[model samples]
Target chain A: MDATPVPETTATPDTECHTTHGYISDKARYLARLKRIEGQARGIHRMVDEEQYCIDILTQISALTSALRNVGLGLLDDHLKHCVVDAAQLGGEDAEAKIKEASDAIARLVRS
Target chain B: MDATPVPETTATPDTECHTTHGYISDKARYLARLKRIEGQARGIHRMVDEEQYCIDILTQISALTSALRNVGLGLLDDHLKHCVVDAAQLGGEDAEAKIKEASDAIARLVRS
Candidate 1:
């Protein structure tokens, strides 16, 4: 009797899950981080409204920026490792496009 | 000499150089930081090209995010302190616009 399990297909699907293929596990973590960041942003708004000291407000804003950027980096990493790598392994037009897309994304981030 | 050097006019101008009034001192720091962040971003690109381990790439990206965000926060803080506060003190449509602009910026960051 045949006992070997069938290998999952590596064919890259053109679907919505492309960038999120391997990031599902980290979804909760990402969401939680975003919520905290949102709260931090609101805190900054309050500081501004209250006319708090400039230095104090700046400090909080700095922290909020750190939090948001961290999340972005996390997502970018996930997309690269799972989606881009997977597509590359398939080795075709899709691979080329994926790599180029990632490069462009990086360029945009660097510019910002 | 007058006991107090003539107080620079708080009158917000309709001309350029509004947001940068208080941030000039930090210009060098910001430039250095942006250069480092740019290098880090390029490094990520190299890692992907080399097909490095996913975890390693993620770690580096995470660090880069922190660095970039810190810079952004610094700039935002400066803008709020120098530009927004000054405008608010003057109290007019300009102040309202500045505050609204900052709020919109916060919202964008949170969404990101």
Candidate 2:
């Protein structure tokens, strides 16, 4: 394995110096999911505005929360598969930082 | 305690025949919070559209999810304080159904 980091000049303009993150490969899919999530949020706002039943509103909030959770989990999976794996292959302080960061994010996800 | 149900004609129009919910008192506040949540969802969608960093996006998603969770919890609390209490006072199948509904909603919140 080549230990040498790729030169910044050779890196793609879209990614800059930092290597492309894992989710980029599924960018369109993520955007579509987020779009639907945004619509769900808007729908909730409208429901509240219209004075819908509390139980019904709560149900919608649960659904939205679940949707967001799924998105978060998907992103985490991609990050682990790509970014974490890449860092591990390189093997150093960067790998440790990446692992720690991922762990912290996982904790937040769990606790949230 | 007056076990007699309030006459439908005497009940307030805003609540119809049903008693006013606990959250009704804080309706405006809930609406405001939901509006902000909607904006947060939109912001997340934009971040993904712009291809922001995955970790940063995850952080925002966490925050959004937490916000929704809080709203769900608040609604549940209100439901318990008002709807469930009312049902319990009535003492029948209605009470059992209310308790079951509340438990189901709580489970959804926890799993989400």
Candidate 3:
């Protein structure tokens, strides 16, 4: 028993696996979204370098902003669906903490 | 080797453990940050309930926004330090993906 590394007793095994899945998927999606955003950012940089119209540059920036917001929302959704839900299921301080965290994230996202 | 579970053939084992550590720490910090944000949010709710001035509510809301941004920055820092760094060390699609993802997150956070 001493030889076996006891996994940290943070959350249940099931919850950990579920949460891990959500995180893994989120990471994958985030990477894909980022690659597209990179192209967009580079395009914006090129536009500025080429002395493109101010409105055009602004428009590209706005699009980039929206794209980024989408990624954030995606991450937020995963966090809620997996992490917060698991924490809530566990109940007590963990749940309360997750709820508050989600609230803060939502507040920030909406405010932007 | 067959029974050992190839660990999904993702990032290296050392990288995985390091990234996991960073993620775990971030989760703890995020939960703490959220708890504070929650109190602020509840205070805002009470202010609204009491028919407090709009500017006051807005100011509280602004504070909340800053708090959320700080949390986001914290997550971003961890992601860059762990995920992005690990991925980059591997040198390939994975690294590129992490870089792009980090860029998107940074862009969104700054835009907000």
Give the alpha carbon lDDT tens digit for every residue of A29-82 in model 3: 689889999899999999999999999999999999899887777676566445
Which sections of candidate 1 miss by over 4 Å? Answer: A1-112, B1-19
TM-score of chain A of each: 0.79, 0.84, 0.76
Report DockQ per prediction, comma-separated: 0.05, 0.25, 0.02
Poorest 10 consecutive residues of model 2 chain A by lDDT? A2-11
Q: Please give the lDDT score at residue B49 for candidate 2.
A: 75
RMSD of 1: 16.9
Give the candidate number with the greatest DockQ.
2
lDDT tens digits, residues B18-64, model 2? 57776878889988787778777777777767766667777788888
The root-mean-square deviation over C-alpha atoms between each candidate and the true structure, in angstroms, is 16.9, 11.5, 19.3
Note the Cα lDDT for every prediction shown: 0.54, 0.74, 0.66
Choose the strongest candidate by TM-score. Answer: 2
Candidate 1 C-alpha lDDT tens digits along B12-54: 3452225544555666665555455445554544444444433
CAPRI tier for the interface of model 1: incorrect
Q: Over 4 Å off in model 2, which ranges? A: A1-17, B1-17
Question: lDDT, candidate 3, residue B45?
Answer: 98
